[model samples]
Target: MSHPVILFEGVGKKFRRSLKADLLYGFQDASRSLFRRKPLEHLRSDEFWALRDISFTAGAGECIGIIGPNGAGKSTLLKLVNGDYRPDRGRIAMRGRIKSLIRLGTGLQPMLTGRENIYIQCAQLGLDKRATDATLDEIVAFAGLEKTLDAPVRHYSDGMYARLEFSIATCLPTDILLVDEVLAVGDIAFQIRCLERLDSLKCNGTTVLFVSHSEMTIRHVADHCLLLFDGEALAFGETDKVFLKYYQSIGYLDRQLKPLGTSPEIPADFAGVASIRALAVKGQENAGGVKVFTGQPVDFEVSYFASVPVDSAGLVLQFWNQADILIATTHSDTDGHRLSLKPDGGRLRLALPFLSLIPGIYRVAGGFVSAGDWLGYGGHLLTLVVAQKQGQAYEGLISIEAKVSNAE
Candidate 1:
């Protein structure tokens, strides 16, 4: 059998991002807006190339992880491979079945109940009635929402919504699995179960390709790595080597490398009306020491001084893999919770209880708002890094507590 189950031969994807002459349309619409008017995102100067001249291969049983900074085309490459987007150039060849878990329950009807959604989601995953029924109970149990399974999905919390998505997608498995940060959707316990499911599939010879900003996720599940920089392959080979290259480039090991802390470092070209303050990452317990591992608790502390009292203040933390696409993010003021940073002073801390983060360069940022406004707290606030040492293994993020299930 051919070792490579999935192969990308000189694949490239280009997007037309144009500035409309009409102030509202930006340049993209004004230039050739008459003939081609699709959203010209991922374009540079009305023409952006998300992926260009990219080439690589994954063995039949290989699990390759894609990592990168934000807007680096990590997700775009998965989309291209999943056939959601056609490559501008090059070809993609796959030897087996392909399934993607990018956005779970993307087509779910909010008005539908969980049971109904189970059917709908199963059908979406190409599962027939019989197959869905076979796995229905397992899914509900895995989701731990058997009681709420009959209720309208609209009332489900964010975690519940995520559970339904995970159950529906993984009930029936496939080869060449493509996942984009979906593992981080559900809570920690559910995430563990989901990872276990994926591991089972991997052991069964399923070839998986995952894209995420979470180094721990990739480290736990992937055996190989492909580091993407600005939408192109920066490094590809043994997962450890590629991750090392990522850390080296991001200056993770340097103690002087101050990430976006109270105030993130911004480019001179950016414009905004806000100020950021002290940003520091320290061991949750030590608060003064460096060198943190996956299980060790850590704190990404941000203290910002707001000029005016804002009703809504949001503090968003983005974890970027070596490649730069955000793998996981938790925001303080995004429908879940919002706090006010008074003119006097306010501090917001994004805590990682067990630092489930795998060994990789992790970037941090502090985005602040006061009086219910987004003037610009400080974009890309700061970056912190974690290193992967050989023979070292740690569970990604908070390891879920579990007990041995024994026969009665």
Candidate 2:
């Protein structure tokens, strides 16, 4: 039987909060190791567990996505897998060559030219001169750095630096790949190229551990997902099921929206000036309904309450796909129709002439802004489902009516 390419068994990592504590712990660990004594497993006053009792496995060619809010130890887990940090406890075992794209400008020398740095990075990755030569043009082309290959990396823009780093890391194939939000660095076109490269790696049987906050990117590439919450493995399983578990446990999909005419639970900071009272969306055909068929019109309404009268307030609504991708955004001020807020609170409705959204679950978020600053905001305030009409075969997140005919 083939062995798993990546395995973690009860892994845990600890870190100190302050530099002084970190230095003290370093000395203590050194002394303990020098004396052949076991290190302390308990947390110190200034230390905390970044990862605790995490366990998972990935077989060859499987792409596993790690997701969580910031400070969830996702980056720490990737660092452990890449051998940059040792687990305080438990075991992590991996076989075959591993390449990581965790940090921007990793393995890059600012003083060296881009072309020279490429060779240095390749050598560090254990690729010999001949191998670097073979892939040199491909890397340069992929990075779109043909014109600036001889320019010093110190002069490269952030986007240029990220593109070069990504190109170098992905120029050659490896048995395992570890990525952490590196794809968010470049422009949209380059991000697409990087994703396509990851797809190519998957097709070529590379085991990948990707860490990102972008749910759409994760859902697109990952077969399995590991969710980390406060340094604990909350869920690990199929991508779809794990995502559902995450959103449900985090109350992302279970928002209990207050009925119309009721004021939102406004915080003190947002109370005096203005606040969002309630939000809702309905189909035009079936008014006040949440479900709608593709190509149908939908009405979005947001109610607001103001302690004092205000002029020229902005109301914005954003539609996010199930994958957490922001599909569309509409602003009331964009069309030069700035809304005025009433002290007693009032509802404003915006209509979409043609929904054009594909069949899928969607989330709506609202924002209320006055005099440039946001007075109040709510996320995941409303959920809407768009279903495909019977006997209709449509593909993709939105439908733009296209007329197709053969010129021949």
- For this target, which candidate reaches the highest TM-score against the unseen true structure? 2
lDDT tens digits, residue span 1-408, model 1:
356788888687776544352354444356656677554433344454577657788876668899877877889998887889987678888877777778755746789999998898788778899988988999899889999988998888877877777676666767778888876767778878877888888877778888888888788888888876656565667877787667654545432334434223343322234445666775322111123444556677676665566666567666654444344566675566877666757666777665555555455543654455444554455554443343444333323434587789
Residue-wise lDDT of candidate 2 within 211-329, one digit each (tens)? 98889899988988887765767567778766765664344553432234222333233444767676666422211114555777777766778878888788877776644556566
Q: Model 1, which residues run further than 4 Å from truth?
A: 1-3, 19-45, 255-408
Provide the clash count, candidate 1. 39
Listed per candidate, the RMSD to the true structure in angstroms reads: 17.7, 15.7
Model-by-model lDDT, in order? 0.67, 0.78
Question: Residue 228 in candidate 2 has what lDDT?
Answer: 73
